[model samples]
Target: MEFFEKLKALSYRARLTIVLHTVFTLAETIGGVFFNLYLWRLTSSLALIAQYQFFFWLAMMLGFILIGYAFKNKGMSQLFRIGFWLNFIFFCLIVWLGERSINWTVYLGLLSGLAAGFYWSAHEVMVLSGTSDKTREMFYGVLMSGESVARIAGPALSAGLIWLGAKWRGEALFGYYLLFAFVALLFLVTELAINRVKDVSFERFSLRGVFGLYQRKAWRWNLWRSFVDGLMISRWFVWGVLSYLILTSEVWLGTMMSLVGVLAIISNILIGQWFKPNLRARLNSWGAALLVIAGIAYPLLLNPLGLVFDQILGEIIGIPLFTFAWLAWFYLAVETDYDGKKRQFEYYAGHEIWQGIGRILSIGLFWLLASNLEQVNLARWWFGGLSLLFIVQWWLLKKVRTALVKAGYKEE
Candidate 1:
């Protein structure tokens, strides 16, 4: 009822946009779990996992750049549809190849990455497409809540499918087969929702328009902020193999992930409904500080209970507030700036490159290090390194926040 009450206050477009995003994210979360599961069940090599992600993000970054250069505003909307079809095809290829799928890991990564790029490039633009500044913060809060819900539901549901299939067929991969078919269907549902939210036009794109954004004093630090934010990409996605190996139970893994969503639901709802424009600084600073503490604990404690604790702290004190603060500032900057909106495609594409560069460097380093370094040492090098990067990211965000305000935009 409370969630429904909040949605009632937003525009129909905004409501539909939230549904679109929620469903896409739900599909992504399900696919993510299975992709990791399939590869690990076959290869059991963490470095190969990193390599797969490396190509995926590399493809994703290049995809954004290519789409930026190639697509007009109208074509931009079509990227959403393209991503779904490609992703569906990727899943089909994986299922078709079966045990032989490991042979196509490189091509698989490239395909997955390009599909993700198309999906997210549209996401970048549509994030604020449906709402005005007046309702932007609330939109984010609700959006966060919905995404959290999806994250929890996706994994729990997947785990159940796996368990059911394992019981019935006595084969774990059978569960993945079922999950893949279901997620492909989800893509169709996501596309349907996207069509309901009518497209809005951004300023005409030109190479010169993109280069002009780099010259702006306010935007310079925001780009750097994105790079710093990217340093944690490895931290975010590579956990499926580790968790499954560590706990040896997808049930436990799914439960832990579901708990994260439960906590996020509480936090995001509060942030969305109760947060004020003035709390941005406090919220961000608090989130970063807790991230340092939680991140450090994450690497230091490697057991099942320890990982659960780490997730709890990250959701409660770290990710939710921090995400809200940064995103509010991020979307606000683009919403108000004259050049920022006119050159929005280039603007988001540039951020993607900077962040993608950071992700590639970190994930690529993981691929290299995981091959050479011991597991315990690699844990410290990976998670501990991300802790420090989060602080730097927050500091850069502070600079951008100040620069945006000084550039004549209000904090809201």
Candidate 2:
């Protein structure tokens, strides 16, 4: 009850931003997870999926590079609209392609990447502008809670729809079409709603200027954090979990994801109330340690029982800690310099580029490794490597905290 009141007390722009984000999150949750499943069904080749993801990240990097130019010339609102429309077009392509989606997976990946790059870059800036450091943590908590609810509903709804379609017409693809169409409609609504939100002024930005950050010792930790974050996103969540799902049932996948979503909701609430800014550094360290442990436990994917335990452990223990801590750290890093307001878009674009490089390396390695190894050995080695990467992420997180402290940024 108190939480609801506090959420309602947010400024109009903040509330609008949260609402818009929730809608977008719901639409994404509906179809985003299944898109990979759709591809795997079309072509049961891990290498092909890796290729698609590689191209996706590559294109995303390119999109980030162009984001600065877009922001300077067009403004954040236009970039947001372009992203929304591109995503709609991508889903439409998925429907049109149908089972033949395998034929154009690479191209689809590129399209998806471009859409994500533009949408996320603009979205990050909006979040920064809409909330202050005082309200940032609470706002993110509400946002994440909303997203978790959407995630819970989205997967179940998608799975039920797919099941019904398969039962009625003897083809689950029909359900996918329905899901994509629904999401496309949501995108249209989002496009219209975006107009109601205020826009940020155009600021001078350059891709070349991003190079200057590399020269600053104070900003070096952010670069490392970006790369590590990218690695985790690709190796653990994208390829690692997807690989497990490929071996399991869709019903099980949907159920497990919903369970995780429920746990996320609880974590969001707790973090919102208890996570203090002063405790950020210590908490983040603990969170990164849990992630490393989760990565080490990835070998449990060998058997069904072990797989279930592994998922439960990750969702219940590892994800909530790491997710909240990382987000808090990110907010700190972005807002610490205060100059982020005028150059926020450029900073985000640069962050995306670094993250993209990390993902490219990860998926590229996955493609190469999977090509050479058998299924059993591949899972072991792939997840084992991912565990090592998590350690690197932890190290980077610590360094980031140290760097921020040295730069005279207040812990609270």
Candidate 3:
């Protein structure tokens, strides 16, 4: 309908790039989840899973560190081109490891992380460059919608593939590995096509030169914001919770994850077309409100259901219940007001910092308390704390939103 027309009018290059990158993201999701599951099956240890996660984050952190600097000095498309090849190589390497029967779950996880690090930092940098403040929110929402769609399909398809692989190859792990290899090839081909796009730049790089971007106050602030935001939700909290949940229940986890992905897709559509275009501030406020509600309800409701069902509910709707709201707010924030060349880089750096902090805090405090306390006691404690956390996070978001609004970041 009119929605497609509006999207087409936004920017042809932006739409094409988003669609192309979405294809890559879809493959990565499918390959990534299955690879992690394959490793889990091989090790059958939560500790191993945790180790895998640790290396994954470490690799990603390193990638971001390097790319953050490069993004400051070099061009966006240049970064994109480099990221594609790096990711493609690592994907092939992972497949090679699988072929050798080197089922070192920890190393495999690290490898995946390393590959992803290059792909993500570059991808974000490039995509963010394609839009400006007036359209950035809608742009991010659309981009995320593509990712959400991929996530929805990835887990469901993975589960089915796992089942089929076991039946056909007589070894489920082998089947998973085969699927991963295929996806990697798909990535390689896509990257090749993307690079061939006329006018895509491939500029030179230098670590020392990137520091010049910091001289611009706008860019500096953007980086700070991104780092803080990234820290809050980055690999830390998500990975820790995921590892814990996987140890508790894998099958249910995959199913519920896909369900969440489906919800995210719906949310993305609403965000991109309706919320982003019309009510940026309202979306921010609503997202905070949802968090406030869910934070209180989750622990209270989950305990009685027992761990497995509780996990399913949490995965499917409980965790994401507040997250979508938070994300809606952040995407809008990024899309507005900030005028800078290396916006995503700066924002991501700051976001990564906060994400790291949040992860550390959650892992240290939330995980500790959740792990040690009696289930009933923990449930009671978390119910109250979750509510409090939601309120506090909402307050913080409100402050940020207010500040941004004061700075004149309103919808057109």
- Estimate TM-scores for all models: 0.94, 0.91, 0.71
Q: Per-residue alpha-carbon lDDT of model 1 for 155-216, expressed as tens digits?
A: 89888988887998998888888888788777766655556246655545655666677776
For model 2, residues 157-230, the per-residue Cα lDDT tens digits are: 77787777788889877877887877887787788768734676546578777877675454577788788767
Pairs that clash in candidate 2: none
- TM-score: model 1 vs. ground truth: 0.94
Candidate 1 positional error at 142, Å: 0.9
Error of 2 at 254 (Å): 1.0
Residues 35-147 of candidate 3 have per-residue lDDT tens digits of 55555466533344445555665666666666665555554555555656666665677667763433464566556666666666655555555555556556656777777
* C-alpha RMSD values across all candidates: 2.1, 2.4, 5.6
Assess candidate 2 and give its lDDT: 0.72
Relative to the true structure, how large is the alpha-carbon lDDT of every model?
Answer: 0.77, 0.72, 0.54
The segments of candidate 2 whose C-alpha lies over 4 angstroms from its true place after superposition are 236-247, 304-308
Q: Model 2, residue 235: displacement in angstroms?
A: 2.7
Candidate 2's TM-score reads: 0.91
Give candidate 3's whole-model lDDT: 0.54
1 versus 3: better TM-score goes to: 1
